[model samples]
Target chain A: MSTIARAPEPAKASLVNDPKVRGLVYQAVLVVVVVGLVWAAATNAVENLRAAKIASGFAFLNSTSGFDIGQTLIPYSATSTYGRAFLVGLLNTLLVAAIGVVLATLLGFVLGVARLSSNWIVARVATVYVEVVRNLPLLLQLLFWYIAVLRSLPEPRASVNPGLGVFLNNRGLFVPKPIVEGHAWIVFAAVVIGIVASIAYATAASRKQTRTGEQSPVLLVALGLVIGVPALLWIVLAVVAGNPIDFDMPIKGTFNLRGGLQIFPELVALTLGLVIYTAAFIAEIVRAGILAVSKGQTEAAHALGLRSGPTLRLVVIPQAMRVIIPPLTSQYLNLTKNSSLAVVIGYPDLVQVFMGTVLNQTGQAIECVAITMAVYLTVSIATASLMNAYNSRMALIER
Target chain B: MSKRIASLALAMGLGLVGAGLGATTASAQATLANVKQKGFLQCGANTGLAGFGVPDAQGNWSGFDVDYCRAIAAAIFGDPTKVRFTPLAAKDRFTALQSGEVDVLIRNTTVTMSRDTTLGLDFPAVNYYDGQGFMVRKKLGVASAKELNGASICTQQGTTTELNLADYFRGNNLKYEVVAFATSDETFKAYDTGRCDAFTTDASGLYSERLRASAPDDHIVLPEIISKEPLGPGVRQGDPQWADLVRWTHNALLIAEEFGVTKANVDQMVKSDNPEIKRLLGAEGSYGESIGLTKDWAVRMVKGVGNYGEIFERNIGEGSRLKIKRGLNALWNKGGIQFAAPIR
Candidate 1:
């Protein structure tokens, strides 16, 4: 009875016989929609702009800000050009993104692995963390951290000293700042050289494994290249050149814990919020990707005389990565974009400093807004291009 | 991870493009007529600044800034009840106005040359004279602004207060670190929490903020003012007629303040000997006709709200909790800058 009711209907033979007419009709509708919408919007904008007499151009970006940013990353004042001001905003945005990315990755990987652990309490805690944080709104979390947690701290001078002179207060988290001197160049150069040598060794090892089925000592040799070369270089450069490294620690002051870098409450709150919120989403993605690798595959690896560690490194992870990379990149991009919420915590990020504050002061809404949108667009586009390259690199090579 | 991530990334890329387009679309080309015809005037204002724009026990808004919104509405329609107030944070205030989300911004917005041109808005007349100052705990023994040189400052982020603090400090060769929060409430908390040595803002705002503190008399406002902030009402650019109406409505209040006119006496003063007052009151002049208004327009405004002085005194003056004096906000004849263009 179901089969009779759901029997196939006769094929629509009209479109097949007149494919040319059908194609032309669809194309005509598409063209009409595109042209009509464009024309209507263009006409409306022209009339509005004319009525308002607002000049549309990029000249305003070169005008003097005539206002000052509170915490500019670079030297700035009322006399600085709007162009430089915009650069300051971009730098702040990049700073937030970079910090948030590092923190979110570390937090995410830890909790992701913990969620899969043998200890019941640890796994449950990780599960609860992922569930609670991921379900809440990021903006609300930022506000909660800023208003409730940070605002509840004691006064500055009565700052809660946790340990090792690290002070926490409503003012902000104050830690000892390291002042890097001019002579740290040779050591840095040695470290970069070691990284390059390790990459070279790893590539050769992978190629040798693919060809001879005989695994090269890539991990040990690469580790040696990374650590041993840097240590040897530091010893040679420092002893031969008699270079000295200075130790400049923060000094206790009458008022503040001065001389060290102070991470204000706004920044601390925003980064902390971004990390917790982003890590939750990342955990889900990590779990799904790990699960995508079948249990049969793991059992097969065991039957082939492989231990759990070797099985993971050689067989499981490589296949699991095909499921992981795409969602992971999406998470990275989302984190980058959501960093704009720094405005809520007053983190002096790109949108808050330049587009919001500067635009208010200068009244050059057209140029200022355009520049801001263009910057975000360019950033996302570049990030997508990089993600694409990474995605392609990890793709399976099919016959 | 890689394949599904690539697809999700593509979908995310589309979402970002949509968001950018959506933001640009809102206020990209808002016209002057659309705001007025909409009936509900979108006025950007503070949520709850006592004596400026705060909600009463009944949840009705009343204060100096709130009154100005009523004045603009009164001028637009004979009724002053057509306003829809949008409470905005310092950072989002101008954006709301710029996006055409608000018709005219009557917040405690400062009138600056940069804003007049670059912000795509027009300031018709200044409604108040504000200057940045510091408020510290009285027990701190900081009587004068000079004592605040080495002190940490708590100020709302994304505002002129931060820059003013820096200017005052650097000009005096003083050193300070600013503890900034995104909202005024947060800044106050930071100060009350003892994160900063002093709380700074326009003197008028300090008066109001201090009134709400845990112990009101515990803090004292310093004498030195750091920056000139001519707080004014703003409207989007491109309608000279509308701009003229808002400008003159503000001036009518100023002129009324100058003429010693109260809301109750505005009708009685309409029959005065002063040509300026008579002409302003619309007895023998057509000032309103040329500006697309009735001659009795000024009379309605003065009769409704009296003048800037009346609004100031009734809301935030000596009789109020703020106990603010008419310093720079006084009329020019009274040795202040509250002068308007001639009513004639």
Candidate 2:
């Protein structure tokens, strides 16, 4: 009864005066302007292309490329369609990016940890490596690796043979390729079965440890299952079927080493350059991630009678991973994109083969550039989402 | 919501009007007028192909292709020096021309069906008649290209030579690996370092590149000529007037050379009585005006860069260090196939 009369409801505001209406109007205008710009740009391009008398469209993908790539992952020739050439280029790019990511991460982690080591020599060496590598431009490093280091190697006639059917020369590194003959599927099936069994065993062992407070040599057992199963079967097949696996050893030919998997110097130099350059940045990232873990956490683990190794692995690393994942994804993306410098060294990567050769051949500037851009966008997005998913999994779970 | 829709419609209307205006501006095709306004001809030349289009230590460009660009400038502006050279890579030559960055591409670009039609380019005339060939080290003992089976060949990318190398090897049922670089220098360097067994390019280019080798005498060009490469000056396809001007400039040079017009004697030849020479020297009909140039256009061109024979000799032929024989580039009446249309 004593409650004051509520203030009269504000008079209905005019549409122009209403904040919500103004925001909606502004947004609508912005959307209209954006759409108009895009429409205008597209139309202008079409009009210009038409006036220039340049043929437009994606039909040229079916045309013969009439060019040969230095390094091809798939079967390709001058007679191959431009579409096939594109796929070959894409696969080559993916191959380098994948290998670069894995090797760079491993080297980076080692260097990062070594930089913080108690041994002065190890720490100083790691610091010098990171500083020197990161300070140099990636393109310069690539050129140095290709021209100064790899190209200076001996010619094929005087190739450096470090035994074991491996040869190194200016042309390439030729290594014996393992040729699996007859019932290769059986070997593949064994690998799959071993991996499945090892995973199941790991789960069961962890459950048992929690229930009975017991421990098992989980890593040792997993490794044995994963590697031993296939190896045992391989030996058995070799005895029964006169060697299911044989190595095609490389032999000196007239111009180069023949009859082996030839890893061209372009690939070697590109990979080496990318790995060394990206590892420097990744080392700093890893160091920052490691240092971000609180000192109290380490002390607490030590007080609980855990050693430095276990404390770092179980308590500190798990927390540090939460800090490491996001930046690590960026470094991975940078390495992938920077691989385009392969064109300078004739690596036959996506930019080298497709954008450079294919674009010049077809003169489809718009289409080729659009496709290359779209490819990079897709790859970046895919890589970002994967790291984001991993980052979410490692995030703290608060009650 | 209705207001938002109305605003969008209004914005779209304005955008359409702007786009229409843009279309009208883009359709303007007076290249000569544009070049005149700029007061210089933008010519695309090779980045560095020695006798074809190489810059000297003083950064002054003087080569066969560079002189061709100079001749064009003389035809248009009556001043040979009223031109600029944009050195373009093999991969970027056509795009540079297509994007209007250069009025003409006098680079050693081969005239092919795809380039003429699909690339929206017109080849005025074959300034240099070339063919793909191979160069190998004498130590390799490769006497002929036929013996180059299983050889790794280095070549400049984005050229007819690369394609011809592949075709020749494939057609002959031979195996070869092609390592193509983005520049002629890289290709030659790779070959010199023994990264490849052979280097393949135009026969003219082979001779030009051999001079840069550490030991020029060590390498020898093979006798095999693989493909016909009619290297010419190219222009945008839609502008026929510009095409005619370029074509006529080349023809004038050839006609002058056929009538024995040299750079030193071009001034004296203008007073001659030969009907064809008088017509070519712009002393006859209004032929030069028809192509948007003054009556003395050919006179300026010949005086500026000399005729075809003079240009060839001074840049890449006997007078130069290249010492290349005229071969197929000699005039039609003088044993070679370099025939040109009459100025009349």
Candidate 3:
């Protein structure tokens, strides 16, 4: 056996020349620099605030907020604590953001599908809508919706009665508010039960279809159980004990409507503006996502004797979702942040009620601003993580 | 990686905290010296209140508050043109003064205990004795503010007017919705377009805003004055010299008006034999020197913007379209509460 000459053993690198040692040293320096900067900033702020004689700290949150908000989702008054006022504003912001996200997504999917239609008029209309809406600044659109569309409506005295105890005017759309009297919890329980039953039925149906190569109308069954059970229970409860729910209809007062759930024109204008603007961008995103799905997939589905609808729904959509989700997450976050613009129209969102009125009243600018920033950061991170979890589930599993 | 992220987040949080605190640096106590060094006086005025601090089509500011700024500039530099106006909203006025963006704030601010103590600001003198009031459309036939129950009221945000509206309505046990806007213009416009049944603000502001309405005669000012709003100029605290200079400048205006000294006749009155006028005009005592100004300080002020009466008349009184009468703002001897300190 020929013995191969072994190569000389390599010498160990000096500490300064070693990549791992150099990286460690650089990281240590970076950490020290960062800590020093934070310390300096904190001390500087403390000194300046003390010198200005401006009261600092979070104690002001307990003080009374002697200002009224336009819209309050919870029990709030001028005598409420600043902390409670902050909560009211936060709820209002979340309400608008949640409604805006759901509505914009539904409208965007429709518009996206229309943009790819074989018909010329349908495609052109969708394209024009996207271009015109996305090009204008959101602020201008908001102003237009508020000043031109809503403000042009007549006064409450001349309000348009759109039938069914509803009034529409510049002040707001007044709809009869349902007041639950008694045994309403029964109806709620029925809804929960119906939902659980439908989910279990859907799972069982899917398993049967996979095993026996048979399909079931799972969606129709689920919808029927959810809606039918709730309606049946509600009607039975009403018949048995007078009425379980009563609607408080609005009455015309001397100056305006007195009762009912009055949606402020500011809220309507803001929601309309946000949904329209954000939908345009989401429509483009959806169209791009659909186009990213390879054409060969659709051909293969058709070759397997699947119809056009099944080919698109089963073979195209699932794959397209993988591409759409990441960008869609960003749009959702942008919509949520843009809700701060409610201040301009007096919607009493977080910025308007808390950052504007509360900060001005307490004169604790640092604490108020820090709280607002932290709230937004927490909300954004929560939204992103939720989307990331869904994205990972939708991710392609490679063997 | 998680540790790195935690540090990054900490850094970002500290940076934001720093930014919020850094914007409100305690300005040096030498505001007057800084103004002189900069060669121009930065005066914070209203964004657009018709008779108080509105800018013209040519961007020339001319209002009661604007004239006060010009008077201060004239007192310091002997030139009324050496002043720059910073138009501020109701919410931004105190911040602007505290941050030293403006040497003084004459934005028709109300003097209140919290503002004086907590906001680190000082009100030199009450320049306009105004009161918060309500204005409603005449077509509504609402005779008094008491009849405005269940009404939607419009007001500017971050003003005492907002608080007073709440207090008044809550005290009377009435239900009313408040739609507060950021600017006075928006508040008035919302009221004009019938978004609100009534508009609540300082009576002076109500009268001024009426002029901008499509039909100025349709609205009527209610008889009730809800709250006392002693509108005045504001300056930062910790600068006693600057505060004194601003306070004395307002006192000089009142004295000039009391002595019947007008802008056009100031030069002729400078040589008068009256001891009070002599001292006020910088002829007898070195009052101006105590405030680090030239001897002709009051004379320059009067020459630039005239007395308090002239300013009120030109901007919002009989000489202007507002035609607001001198009700409570008249001098003490004239059956009003406007009293000035003795120049002697």
Best by DockQ: 3
Cα lDDT over the full model 3: 0.88
Q: Write down the lDDT of every candidate, Cα atoms only.
A: 0.74, 0.87, 0.88
Error of 3 at B133 (Å): 0.7
Q: What does the lDDT read for residue B188 in candidate 3? A: 83
Q: How many residue pairs clash in each candidate at the backbone level?
A: 17, 0, 0
Where model 2 places Cα greater than 4 Å from the true spot, the runs are A1-11, A211-213, B1-28
Docking class of 3: medium
TM-scores of chain A across the candidates, in order, are 0.79, 0.94, 0.95
Write the residue-wise lDDT of candidate 2 on B1-344 in tens digits: 47645654554445545544444453538899999999999999888988999898888998999999999999988899998999888888887888788899998899999999888788978999999899999988789999987789998888888888889988998988888888888778878878899999999999999999999999999999999999999998888899999998899999999999888998899899999989988788989999999999999999899999999999899889899999999999888999999888
- TM-score-sorted candidate list, best first: 3, 2, 1
Instruction: State the DockQ of every prediction.
Output: 0.27, 0.39, 0.56
By TM-score, is 2 or 3 better? 3
Best by TM-score: 3
The residue pairs found clashing in candidate 2 are none
Evaluated on CA atoms against the true complex, candidate 2 attains a DockQ of 0.39
